[model samples]
Target: MYAPRSPPPSPTSRQLAIIRFGLARIVPIDDEAPFAEIAAAAGLGEVHVRRLIRHAISQHVFQEPRPGVATHSAAPRLIAEDADLAAWVRWRADDCWIAAYHACEAVARWPGSEEPNETGFAVANPTSLTMFDFLATQPERASRFAAGMRLYAAHSDLDLQYLVKAWSWGELPKGATVVDVGGSHGEAAIALARAYPSLSFVPADVGGRIRYMIHDFFTEQPVHGADVYLYRACFHDWSHRYAVRMLQALIPALKAGARVILNDVVVPGPEEMSPGLAAGVRTGDLGMMILFNAGDSEMAEWARLFEAASSGFHFKGGKGHRAQGCGFWRQSGRDIVHS
Candidate 1:
């Protein structure tokens, strides 16, 4: 009979620091190199490099077959393959980890503050600037953050094809206009345009997109009467108060038959999900709390948000309602009221 093994202990801060140093320095030059050679490449002493490598070996990040040789394992190999993945690791080690360190003090001082600027990130940086503003001043850090987001999108199930396959976009009339709000880089719009040639897309990011309307959801929307308004993974970054305002901004522009589609996680109740699934969402919730005092909403909260936005709005059918959840809300027309 086979015996079950216990899970490995979490890596120590020193271990993580060593991992970051090695990832930034050693991995790029050679996946497998002598300890002395790696030390020379990284401008560190051989003894210290061996110690860090041994600790990393314990975590399966790298391998040491003999006393003097170091080689990349699956984890380090994967990181070496993608520059963005490496940037993500560095960002986590540098930025996110620093913010997390100050989270307790931030919570104690703020005492339920809803402002994003009052976050742990803000507390750690010793600036009145929001994390976004702070990152703007640090271009390299900002570049890493952007690269990390791209890595996240590339690895996660949140790919554009997932949205295209899940939603019934073909149901709409040919030449129907779809407005992608806050559509950074127009990734989703471009993907959808390629898949459904019949549909017209206006991505509200970057210049020179045909008839691109600069609509900020915080204020009133500029593009009115579009067949569909698409908001993908946008709402979870804000508190309910801001989320309500964002939704309300759409009300003025939304014509009778207009559909507002939100592609975001609809967090399930604790009892409704497996422990692993629950942990995944709750982990995201904690990150949101630390970063922006925001959270993933449950289905009831989503329904309430729409109702609070306006009585004329109603929740409608949606595919891909479970994994990487999406929801559809329709604006009620006078003649064909949906209540």
Candidate 2:
């Protein structure tokens, strides 16, 4: 006799909406409300609410204790308590869901474009504008995206403290200047300043809280010959083509012996990632693919990127942090070794 086999179940938009609806209304209460009440609050039909509730229960998002009464469970309660988690869920349901829905059509149409505007997000919204530009036009979605990033850092343990502890910042000479390229609001610089009082920082970002001149990374870096040019969670947003441009922009400003440190994901090779970390890393890779046609780089890919970016950049090595990854390198006197 052959062993039994069942088809794998795929996720549906209805399932996402069900969870989103549950998150919006279902709270811990004395009495469980019937499906009709939930439907009224959610602006959904009674029969539709009943089916959604049943699906949600199967997914462990909500619970149905009695025949018709729906109540809060552990998962829904957590979403209710954590504002960031709730915002993340909302972003997933509203933004990412739509983007993913339109991804197939985008791929078929654009084929292999690396521009951010060529992404599924653009196709879904029927705009040629990039994500940032589009988000700028829609304040609410932009706010949600910002909140989602902050919350994601909490979820992934990729906070300022991790950067402070992961590197050897104290070893740098006193008064050494560290430029945070593409560092929004200078949070990393602020954290480093606290950890290493002997050093100074320059933040190259718009609307920064610090007292530095605003500069774009795509343009020539204004602060030349800094001790270090730090890129935290920035390079991964671009494809190798644009990433090389960003590095080239910084090359003229890099003095001899200047270090280039990256605080981003170093994607693991096949069968290399631990089971616990595989999901997060792969999801991140997929997210970049959908949004910008970019991706996290593996160790070899990182080295190759530096080589391709400039003949002067040398690939030192890389390692993992709590959840984030690190790549270390410096401007070499000799020509860069091609992979």
Candidate 3:
């Protein structure tokens, strides 16, 4: 006789409301703006925010005291502490992404451009510089952007901890030097150094960002000594050609036998084939596409890109080299030997 299967757990109303409040950060929500006030601020009827808050309350994403007031609770705590979410919010809510969202409509009208046809938005409203470019002009927004990124970093730290702990680094050769190519503030590098005291980590990024990391984390003096490098999610922002060029820059510093560790999503197989996994992969791909006009890549694609960079350079498998559930590779001749 087969045993009965357990039913899926149901979310509490309070939990759902809290989640809605977090999402509200993406939309517009303010303590000064109650449900009706928020609706007015959004230029909608007062009942709209009320209806939304009621539905969210059912989901437990926010807490509603009495009839229409909504406030923060435990549900939004995760989002509050998340760095990527903060970055996304700052990007999306900024005038640039908002303008781009409006501009997306123009794609159908005009089609030709020397650059990639995918504009952040396609509709014709007002042509302006990029959000980051605009932020450069407005230093205050840039500061806000930095603050948002820090919030996102808090959440990312947990995930980084998991990845670092799961991937063994003790096997790396003594005096192994790591370069975090685009590490924002050396958080990942610090974690790795703490875990493996012998390895040295160097967190690298563009000038301004790197300066911030030096000020914030390295204030107590350099922690990783000189072995490991924590790049975080920098190289993935560029095309494979540029990524290889970035790697080439590090060859002089990279000790022979030192490994490059990339912490990013590896796109999975087709959608109909692996529904759940495909959904996640596709979502990540779309995120990269929308945000940076980039997409998630397959392991084979990564291997090919790495092999193309140098003649003898290939994936050396040991610890911290496994590609999650995917296969591994080694460079041999012009071919990438996968196992």
Which number leads on TM-score? 2
Q: 1-339, model 2: which lDDT tens digit per residue?
A: 998887633344544674567534554544577887778887788888887667778877678888878887776667767766666777787788889888888888889888888988899898999888899999978877888888765554566776777667788888788888887778788888877878888863323423465887899988987888888888788989889998889888888888888887676676866765677667778888788878788778878888888777877775564434522121111122222
Please say which candidate is ahead in TM-score: 1 or 3.
1
Which candidate would rank higher by lDDT, 1 or 3? 1
**Which has the higher TM-score value, candidate number 1 or candidate number 2?**
2
Question: TM-score of model 3 relative to the true fold?
Answer: 0.57
Model 1 segments more than 4 A misplaced: 1-20, 23-31, 204-211, 317-339
What TM-score, computed on C-alpha atoms, does each candidate reach?
A: 0.83, 0.85, 0.57
Candidate 3, residues 38-67, lDDT tens digits: the string is 565555666756766666566666677666
lDDT against the true structure, per candidate, is 0.73, 0.74, 0.49
Rate residue 259 of model 1 by lDDT.
81
RMSD of 3: 10.9
The parts of candidate 2 lying over 4 Å away from their true place are 1-15, 19-23, 26-31, 204-210, 274-280, 322-339
Q: Order of all candidates by TM-score, from best down to worst? A: 2, 1, 3
